[model samples]
Target chain A: MDRIPILRMGDFLLVTIQVDMHDQLAMTLQDDLTSQIEKTGAKGVLIDISALEMVDSFIGRMIANISGMSRILDASTVVVGMQPAVAITLVELGLSLAGVQTALNVDRGMQRLRADVAGKEADDGRHQE
Target chain B: MAVTKSEVIPIRTEHDIVVARQAVRRLSVEAAFGLVDQTKMVTAASELARNTFIYGGGGTLQCESLLEGARRGLRLTFTDQGPGIADLSLAMKDGWTSGSGMGLGLSGAKRLVNEFEIESVHGQGTRVTITRWK
Candidate 1:
């Protein structure tokens, strides 16, 4: 599909990459997420990729890019549901995906997102005080 | 070293890369590849497909099911008639991309497969063959 659906819940934006995304589609998602985070003023982003069967170098780079973009936009990004085989292959492929945060599933991902945002807010509060 | 089944998919666009990966996934399953092996094969196919499209300037991905006695394997061959790679050794090095890529396409693909072979002529074309046994 040309577009991946981005859902909003409170201050968090959720995205599930369910299909075998082509390179263009992956780039589109990265751009779309950046805009969504800005437009919604989202504090956190949870990207569910449990359905993703493979995280090739391109996909791996996209995920890392999304994570970086979200951070620079003042939003925390968490990638969830990576298949075991995909993870293994990614390592073998030599993509460490450094600077990308990951969680086991949607539940854990959401939890981590919430915690990270909350932690950021706490630091902000301290700064303001 | 016999191909039990084979199919060639064109790698002329981004969508074609997805098609090649899907074809490899299905063929890998038919060969009874484990989930990890199937994923690895498909991932390798993706890297090669991109090379065929981006660096090689469009090509074809050949998916084959191989049978060797009691073992079954999946093989993917990517070919393109583009300007070909001028430096095979440097091109194969990690973190050295000709374009704006992350520079791990060829090297990473090699790590994900059991067998990796490459052939290229500076002015002619390039061919990359990779295989994984189940």
Candidate 2:
């Protein structure tokens, strides 16, 4: 069984999609990512899709599902490194990947995630006070 | 215009969809399609291949590289011998899926290409054809 590895960096989970994902593989990734988020209690997830040449409706939905699931598990997801062509295709496919934050690269994605976590922490502190 | 070169690939499972997408990408590039055009064609092929596998119970893809006058293009036809769609108009409507998908395959694929055609007969089979010109 081929699996996409999920790496952890500090409070964030990193997944770099390098292969052309099949349906089963994409489902597995969704499952693995959600479970990993639970086990690590990560604050954010960064998925680097720069290597993916195409993302159809199915994959687009999977990305949205991952982001939604992460949100429910007390984490944020940022999809980064989308190619211009992929973006165009996704829009044409009628999938905007709404509700999922995006960035140009991994570094910027990480920064956004950190800021998100910090904002949440601030809100939590204010509530406790 | 006649198809210059054509290849047929079977779509039985998920792996076949990936292969079909790669084939579309290769043919589009060979036909001198731009990056956005290649991506759109590959994405459209992938969507149709999934539809063939999931809804049509497997099918075959006919990929053709076209040269008409000074214009070049890539065309693909997906045919399946499964239960055909009952309502094509509904199927082509966005957010109307017969399965668990987001219901964007047919309509979205149509938006990606320059030419789109679909023919289906209930209890018989279905065929979808698309072409993107460069």
Candidate 3:
């Protein structure tokens, strides 16, 4: 019954992974995140992984799946706060997380999301006019 | 060189994979490996533990702490009685997976450690050994 909480902050959903997630927990988070995005109509997702010391291929793939699903649902995902060691291990593990965007920290991630949403809205307004 | 200390852990389910990672991390830290080295070892352990559970059906992990001369190292040996791999050369290739995984488990784990070895018998089982020296 352990679940990672998904917090909605205005137009974005913020997920801070603080535990050493097992495979089931990672899968559940993916499902919960997509459902939350649909229900809230969020435009962006920011995943904080600073607290995670290790990231294996399974967890890396889960992040990619979440990003891809969010993209299809009209949302952008930014993975932030990856530890230097974790990043090195991920690259060595051959999981580049191809389609997902990353930032140095949560503050920068939020700024990036805000700008992305604002840009999308501007494009939409132009199309309407 | 002989291992100064060793412990054996079972890999039966998903939860065991997490435990395996923690054990590897602890051993790597105790060996005085840097943060990057510890993370690499732990990540490799996670991949192998999952492989043991999902592909091998179940297995045992032996973690050993080694002291060779002035160098310290951590070594892990995973053995499973499941159906053995028929094509080791192909399995070691990147992006080659018999399961739903990204196929990076074997090759990726190899890249993370300083030494890697694998043995399999067609009908018997598989054994993988890896070591990282600090």
Candidate 4:
């Protein structure tokens, strides 16, 4: 029942997803975050899937969508803290993320987000020259 | 022992995704492989399943185990009778995605497996083949 939390860490946006591992809830949460990515335009988004016990196709595609759309919206996104079981399941199902950036922990994801934002900003500045 | 196993599993909804994962795991475990091979196969299958359902509306996943003279491996084939890919090359490129994919479906699957092939015809459907070994 607890919704995903979106917090701004400097220029980056951290999304803390508290999952119940329930199928229906995972679907709901994924939909909610997908829309949030569009509405907030946060520079960076991090998803904490540590509490998640399982992720089906719907949720998997939704996560992929979130990361995909975030780029279109000019925001960077990373998935953090996936359990070994969940990671293994994802691999077996061939749902392994191709473009979505993932980090071992929330801190590392945030650091990467910060770096990504800085790199993009630097690129933009150089292009303006 | 030249024992070959092949079956076409359907992917209708999200639950089917779990079944697909299980099938792949069983195949990998039966071969007595390590975590890396298992992980790669699983990851590649996951992306293909997602693509089949999302883009193809629904489809079938075919898995074949090849054990030819001590060379043990598995081949995964995903087929969908949905709208075929318009641009195969671009779709395979990283960061290029259709619908909600993170632009990693095809390319990501490619990296996870030893061999990858995709055949599609516009307005027809798609067939993706991937292989992994012990």
* lDDT for each residue of candidate 1 in B4-116, tens digit (9 for 90 to 100): 88898998887899898889989988999999999988888999899899988999988888999999988889999999899999999999998999999999999999999
Model 2, position B41: C-alpha lDDT score: 92
TM accuracy, model 2: 0.99
Better of 1 and 4 by lDDT: 1
Off by over 4 Å in 2: none
Each model's total of backbone clashes: 0, 0, 0, 12
CA lDDT of B35 in candidate 2? 96
Ranking by DockQ: 3, 2, 1, 4
lDDT of each: 0.91, 0.95, 0.95, 0.77
lDDT by residue (tens digit), candidate 3, B55-129: 888999999999998999999999999998999999999999998999999999999999999998887889999
Worst 10 residues of 1 chain B by lDDT: B1-10
Off by over 4 Å in 3: none
Q: TM-scores for all candidates?
A: 0.97, 0.99, 0.99, 0.61
The alpha-carbon RMSD over the true interface for every model, in angstroms, is 0.6, 0.6, 0.5, 5.9
Task: Write down the RMSD of candidate 2 (Cα, Å).
Answer: 0.7
Model 1 DockQ vs. reference = 0.92
User: Highest DockQ: which candidate?
Assistant: 3
